[model samples]
Target: MQRLATALQIEHDASLRTLNTFGLPAVARTLVRIDSARAVRRVVDHPEYGRAPKLVLGGGSNMVFTRDVSPVVLKVEVRGRRLVEERPDAWIVEAGAGENWHDFVAWTLAQGWPGLENLALIPGTVGAAPVQNIGAYGIELKDRFESLSTVDLVTGRSVTLDARTCAFGYRDSVFKQEGFGGLAGKSVITHVRFRLPRPWQPVLGYLELERRMHETGNFAPDAQTVFGWVCDIRRGKLPDPSDVGNAGSFFKNPVVTVEQCRDIIGRDPAVVHYPMPDGSVKLAAGWLIDACGWKGKSVGRAGVYEKQALVLVNRGGASGAEVVTLARAIQESVYGRFGIRLEPEPVIV
Candidate 1:
């Protein structure tokens, strides 16, 4: 495909190594950067590309590409952020789907918004957050979500969907679902609004945060303080992609029933687990992998991060298949020992 003198930026046989955080090698046959909502409509109307399958990409922080892509890659580059409204009870903020999530959180704090403090330093774009229902410490995006606007791929129609319409769950949303009425691959999220509640109380529920508070001898901390602490904690634990390639956490913390939790506890008293409000138990996947003696272990160029067992890092020039292989071996071992299946957090492409 040749470039046309149009608003859309198109590239054929685009190298995806630098695009993905893991630095996995892959190529897109046709890659188009969509800077605005209108770009999506234009894509649907393109002469040669119209009717072709599409794959939407954000920061590529949460995806692992194992092979070259055949679908047209729509790299979302939409940008903007603003204060939507300020009520007595809460403050509403809106951000483009393509905006860097961590930077957006920092901007909110600089503007005196406090609700997103716990989620500070998380990777990926604001658009990907809702799709993954990204969470950290004690708060999930749904806890602060207001609504989002998206453009339909088939009809090029725009619509705003509330939390219910998104059907958010643990690291999932309607955008990640593909059953009947599911929105995955059928729409492009252009903008997302977050509802930051007023009179913010610090979320010190997580063990690491509590340790930080105790070590600092400060029971009460501000939002910026919390933000700094979260960033520090993340930096110390997870390897920076600029230094070492990684896709953050590798697996979702599996949630099991209370009875099932007891069964695991009976076998291993030292298993790291958290009790949920609804009587379920969330087991730490990192702990499970570490207990199985997989931390700092490697299969080819892909290895688990020594500092944080949750992260799988690309040691030098690692391939996506190596990462997947390492992940599968960890899963099989964990299932053999704990009888719990670990689901990968990254989208395997």
Candidate 2:
């Protein structure tokens, strides 16, 4: 029998293990694939599923499911990309929310706009980028963002929001917020626009990129070179999701005040940290985890990635509950030693 909820097709008892990078076993009670702005509205107007709780899923790279999902899952698959505008100072490009983030970055460079090169090879969708405020190798999504369009769940109205309204911060945005003016679980992003600056300047101050420069004797590299370098660096550090089931960085680097930083440095001078412009310091979560001797360690079927302590991998057939157990253990150990609690990066379901 053909199952239809108005214009939307619903999948019952949908397997989510294949959708998420962690590859944990779970099922979505109801699932719908959204490919356009109208499709999102259809979901909002549906009779039964409309008012029920909904979960907007992107690339599923940053999600961990601990149990069968009860909320309706709207898997965004909207697609398209094009050059929007070219001004003297910048070239504006746009892409559908569902576009693969890494692919879009590569596509922008191919089209001769090169500002997104440093962010190459990051997993997840373009829609998820702004939500996570994704960053890498000295560049962040906000660094090249212009604006994005979203469909409100209640009103079914499409609105365009700028960076200010998005309230982008370290791995966070209004999309992840839930107080007054928060958009979390309230809207679905349909399209995203990027303000790629006209004159491409390679962002190469990052340690790994700098080391690459020193090794290659190339003080100045093009966008493609930087892209290659970032891909190589990430490949060496992070295990591919295909080979190992794991979400990318499991925790956000804890930011501390100058006094706290000094105290930590006093206790452990070898701690890896980055000083921010605001005078606070960001300590590497991976370094803290490794210091606690958690790398390559496991709790049941879940374990820390042998290559990067910041990542939790499914050794094989691991349950999401086991993964959470492993994460908590790491957090407890790190807090015991450094007196700092690590916040997870992925959305735990």
Candidate 1 residues 207-289, lDDT tens each? 99999999999889989999999999999999988789999999999999989889999999999999999889999999999
* Shift of residue 162 alpha carbon in model 1, Å: 0.5
For model 2, what is the C-alpha lDDT against the true structure?
0.93
lDDT by candidate, in order shown: 0.93, 0.93
Clashing pairs in 2: none
- lDDT tens digits by residue: candidate 2, 248-322: 999999999999989999999999999999998999999999999999999999999888999899999999999
TM-score for each prediction?
A: 0.98, 0.98
lDDT of 2 at 317: 97
Clashes of 1: 0
Q: How well does candidate 1 score on lDDT at residue 106?
A: 95
Candidate 1, lDDT over the whole model: 0.93
lDDT score for residue 343 of model 2: 97
All models, RMSD in angstroms: 1.1, 1.1
